[model samples]
Target chain A: MSSTPTALPDPMTLREVYQQQQPYTRMTPLLVSESLSKLIHGDVLVKAESLQKTGAFKFRGAIYRLLLLTPEQKQQGVTAYSSGNFARGLAAAGKILNVKVTLVMPADAPENKIASAKKLGANVVLCQQMEPSREEAAQKLSEDIANQNGSILLHPFDDPEIIKGQSAVGVELMQQLQQQQINCQSLLCPVGGGSLVAGCSLLFDPFHTSTQVFGVEPEGYAGMNQSLLVNHLSRAPGKNLSHCDALLARSPGKANFEVVRQTSVKGLRVSEHFVVEAVQIAFEELKLVLEPSGAIALGALMQYPAQFRGQTVVAIATGGNVDKALFTELVNK
Target chain B: MSSTPTALPDPMTLREVYQQQQPYTRMTPLLVSESLSKLIHGDVLVKAESLQKTGAFKFRGAIYRLLLLTPEQKQQGVTAYSSGNFARGLAAAGKILNVKVTLVMPADAPENKIASAKKLGANVVLCQQMEPSREEAAQKLSEDIANQNGSILLHPFDDPEIIKGQSAVGVELMQQLQQQQINCQSLLCPVGGGSLVAGCSLLFDPFHTSTQVFGVEPEGYAGMNQSLLVNHLSRAPGKNLSHCDALLARSPGKANFEVVRQTSVKGLRVSEHFVVEAVQIAFEELKLVLEPSGAIALGALMQYPAQFRGQTVVAIATGGNVDKALFTELVNK
Candidate 1:
């Protein structure tokens, strides 16, 4: 009888990822607070991706993809599609590596992102809304470039290498906890493409503690929950419902979903209204700007206080690259 | 024949002031930058007063006044005037120090500041604005409070101890410069009431090098500049032209003014239009929110970039608590 080989227990070793990716990515601190602890009825720590270079955690995956390139590939450069954080990250990384880049962005991307990418010397391509999705339009552009000039396409997530790279955040989190001598009961992170949570689970698996990890998604974009319940894959990359434009992954990453399925982690969804309230609370109380997607974990904490009470929890404060106009709209309203 | 003792090189050593007053004050960091170096033509560093706890440097002097209170004085609490940073600082410090504070504010004071003061547990006494000088009415309130119950009055500036406490920013700056091993050619700080620039001069004076200190004042509030030409004090505190409301300080501190006069520093005034532009640049380029007063130095940089072309300069980004509504109004326009 023939048996299928067991999948690797670890997606990638923490040490190897650190050595390969540490130079390019930020070691965003796991900031803990006495005040936050008191309010949440437990010790609370925030992995401040808002403070990450380029103002988002997307840099970790983008830079990791850049690192795997051959010198020739580096010279030829790469291309990707994102309307927001990823666009900024790829452009920024391209500027640092002195590599030419082509970006396929939605025509309605934030002006700041467009200007920032242009400032970093990326040849930005505007796509029509006629395409069903920005991701599909971008994939088509990537294929065209691959056929014509053999340029590499850097997928934002769903790529195994990118998933492995995002796992570095977990490694950093564990290292930081050890340094501070603080033991956490659970890890709470926002789910976008599911790669971040998927990669995190692999890192947490070896600890062998009953420390449960939870992934939060905006209520409208919680495709991961439905996928996990029935084990059926969705056709696309984002969920159908989301006021948070960033967290609208229609489907989870296949590899990441596999890892997340095996881990003893629970997933939860938060309402768009709660996310807005969380954003306001962050500004008024913590003096932080948490974009709608970034506030999902905090929104869960506020909406369901009992679920998190008495547990030492770590929440990822994902990013702070808010459009000035959108920020005014939300804050003023 | 007898003569009064000559003033000490640095009168009223503020080391003790800083130590005892620290709890009541927010120790704003003097953040040095590599990015700013590209614009100022030298190694440009920003002392980010914009990041101060109450979002301005005025908190330093307000807290210093509160800290210097005698036991009897502390029991009765404190009172002050103005509808800007000082009001906010007094309220915040008063809450922490367990002192009751009553502020005489103009009816036109930004709703944000008034609300912030109320949130911090200060009693607000709104006054009519028909009077040409609101400072006069504030002084009257301070006197009445002193006469009735011996409540201490905290002046926005023009107090020696306040000047001494404000000097601590200078102290921190010199230490930061030394730690970074950067030999700064000059220090440029906004000249509001002159306390900030004056205090900074004292801090820079002890360096034993020919370091020029410059002050940037809003064009409308050029009281300090006019005063400098005549070698005579001009415009009583809070009685002068007010464009940058936070910098409406008419008179420089006597000791602070003396230091500015004695030092080899220059003063430059930038237009309001340029100030708005600088504030925009701050938001776009530096990813910071700066009030008009806070952006005055950046305004100066835009107006006369050549002046800073070759020298290692430090510009104090002195405040950031602009009314969000006002900021939207100005920037959107």
Candidate 2:
């Protein structure tokens, strides 16, 4: 696939993708954080994608992906598997475009996410937990369903199309920052399959020479961090306790890892405790509600403030779709 | 004063205020709520000023007020009184403009409010709860401080300039709505001293012809509501066991009420129960953390859904500065 691969797309193509998706998406605010600026002694901007359609940034990629489908393919529909965020995003996108979408999700996915996907008219198949990660199990089941229904199978994050769609975040952020005359020194993004970070790093530092862009992941599931350290795709010990259900991907996507290496994306690992604290801080200071995975990039700041002090930074809040009880418990804690 | 009353300003003045305040404040997002749209069967845009600087719409007025002070007045500084939101807004505004500020507050004001004022280098005088009302007592002390210090005594929400400054919210909202091609049929703004609603009503329906803009107040502190019912200023029973600390004004401001009467602004009163529910829903559905007073306008919808079921509505989430403990309890409940 690498030998015959197409050349990486240019920035204009990415910007066009963002512009096309504008009608189907909300241009989430680029909010300046006063409390964070005081803490860092520099400007801190939050790209609040938590307020995006379906309450996550995944909708950008999902909608863009569906828009690119051929007329026949759209009529035939598509199949995919996701933990939660991607499922809701894809479901909503499919519903909007009048395309049938079948999703295979883990049985233990959040109730609200599952309910939201079903409400958006997605046919959901709940896969039981299995070896090689619940995601892999769901993926295998999704492939089988796609074959049975003679439908196109779409990868949630590994596909180049998905990565290109995710580039909308970088394009939008750069547009907003330029309008405000803010030159960001560092950017932090929560990494699951690494698509968002990879897409953004390509835009912010295509040559991988400067502009520190860090991908934050939970401690035990820091596959992107581990992979970057050895300069190769590597798996992490994903069998640890974590509240960030959306960020438990054991390994980065193959295409995503390739882009990260090319763009020199840095990685950070945060503990659940810091993630919980970040959620509370987001609610209190930022006035935004972020799920644990969504707050991990913020946790990276709290975990190592000295490293970023006096540097202009931007953090991407990825999703906000936790169950009310879980959200309350995290807030109380 | 009414013998030759100062003429009310025009929309050009309001747009200029927003332009001048652009650098000092955030262009808060005008977000369409998908969940809310589904519930109401029409569009529901949330003009979230909760993410505004110093955590409320009061900052727009406070900063514009300070910017408008005469050179001598700016050097001498200013004195004002507030329950919580205005004090923080004015203090922060003064600090930014290098003007000394003195604030008179009720002794029982929120701890965070007092700390925020002091942190911004404001001299705070805590007035004891005496006869009349806590706000009235604070107002009297503020006047004395202004006279002793030879400082300008600024009303929190009474002056015409202050009203014009607060008009930024309406101007900004209209710009956003027009960009989206959305015709706002109904607008809901939480009312304390009535600046926000008055400014917005004037912009949307100056001749009292169309566009129903409602001033929402707490159940017992419905001073703006009571005042608009008659054609004259009237007081409300502000004594209530509620947690909306930022909205305890016993009566609408003199100038604010006059503007409301001219604009033919309508009003609504919400119970504390729905306010709490709105806060929780904000966390759950909208991915925003709104203070109870900020969430009261959303509560107006929950209180009487029938009145606004099929209309395009916009609710103003005014501030996001409630105590963490109180927020947690409210979210948990």
Candidate 3:
């Protein structure tokens, strides 16, 4: 893989994108966690993107991606593959923008995710092949559908436009921190294919800011962490099972990895046990319903509290689209 | 009971209280519900107080009540009786203000609520008496304790200052609605002892604004609803079981009822089944964790969609202090 990367979006462009999406996107509350703050002996803030439209930060990217579509592309529509969050976001965005959206999801994806996507007026095709991984199989199916229908193909997280769109989360977080007069020392974001972290990292001036950004991933799917360690793109071994269905991507997207590599983003992996505990903590303490993937950043904090101890920290709770049964089982555990 | 009431606080006073408490309180997000809007053929916005500090709007009133205490009262501390939400809120408020708090709670209150109050540094006493109603029994026990210790007795919902503090919710809602240019026709608040409804009602001018304020209650615990209909205070029959633990108060507090009665606030009630469904809907659609009592207002909208059809509406989701077992049970159902 090439080590060199394309230029990232400047802060001005990021702000412009954010301003354009401001009316459509929700300004999710930046909540201070008393319990976590006490535990870590520092201020712990949660940027609850789980409360965003379509129950995830993906909606920002999805909406922006659709808005940037060429007139012809918008008319023809778009297709994409996602385990859940992005599919729902894109489906809703498509509905809002009057663009046709087709989603290819794994056959075994959470029932609620599939149902929500369909309910949002997406044409959903379930891919049953799990031999080469559900994500890859679904991506292949989506590409085939796009080719057949002459629709533009959308990558759930790897695209530059999508990453630019995801930067709105970072833009909003910076604004909130400024408003609250908070100077956070550390920032944590959950990484699936790394679009959220990649986009967010673009906002902080690594040369001047003391803030250290971390891309947190589940243990089995620590591809981003591995790639960051090796200083090159790498795939996760994918040997272990995890409940974070949304963070099961085997590798970071090329565009996302490129952006992250150009920034000062460190990668951290959290155990499955801690991810479940994070979900429960979010429910009990933060009063937020976070999926395992969304809670992964907080899970990293719990897993490595000493590293962030006595330092103001911000954790992005990226999504809350977990299946009811899984959420119940995890919280109960 | 006498219908004549004490003078209500004006809008300026309400805004003053809100400003004083603004720095301490969370400006919880006002979320638009596409599903609910489609169901009623109107714009439905949810004021998610479930995301408030101590996981309920009770924190607003609790903090304000403690702030208003004299130096002697602060030094001597205070005592109150509540099923759960107010206990947790008061305990948290006391912790923040460095005031000692003692709470008398019904023995059967949810385990999480009791645990949270204790965790917040409150001295908790469980009242086992059920003959005169759990709320009355607890109130008596708290009064006895207050008298013995010379600590001031605080009414959980009946106090005028507390109502003024809770008016912050309405104040914030109006600001958010104004910012969004939304002119909602109806406002619904979950009614327990009715402080929230009364406080919010004071903000909307009955003689000017066309918006109708509603105090929504569980079917069996419709004390506030019944009182509003009869133009005086009344007690609920309290013969049926309900999951709305926070809203089991047999009658409205005198101050709350008086304030509500002076306004044009109507009453609405929803069944146990719909309250459970509202919790599920809040979880699925709004990505919010709402306790049964917190969800009753949304339940009212679900129960009476015809009445709110084609009109913009706002429902205050008051709290998210439910136990894990019950929340799991309700959402799963």
Per-candidate DockQ values are 0.17, 0.70, 0.87
What is the C-alpha lDDT profile of model 2 across A258-330, one tens digit per residue?
A: 8888777888999988999989888777888899999888888888888889989999999999888888788
Q: lDDT value for candidate 2?
A: 0.88
Return whichever of 2 and 3 wins on TM-score. Answer: 3
| Model 3 alpha-carbon miss at residue A305, Å | 0.5
Sorted by TM-score (best first), the order is: 3, 2, 1
Higher-DockQ candidate of 2 and 3: 3
True interface contacts reproduced, per candidate: 0.05, 0.71, 0.83
What C-alpha lDDT, on a 0 to 100 scale, does residue B56 get in candidate 3? 97
Q: What is the lDDT of residue B81 in candidate 1?
A: 80
lDDT scores of the candidates, listed in order: 0.70, 0.88, 0.91
Q: CAPRI verdict on model 1?
A: incorrect
Instruction: Give one digit per residue, the lDDT tens place, for model 2 in B150-260.
Output: 999999998888888888999999899888888878899999889998888768873633468899999899999998887678899877877888888879988888787
Clash pairs detected, candidate 2 = none
lDDT value, residue B248 of candidate 1:
59
The TM-scores, one per candidate, come to 0.82, 0.95, 0.98
- For model 1, residues A20-109, the per-residue Cα lDDT tens digits are 877676566454433457677998777767656676777787777787788999988887777677778788788777788888776766
Q: For residue A202, what is the lDDT in candidate 2? A: 70
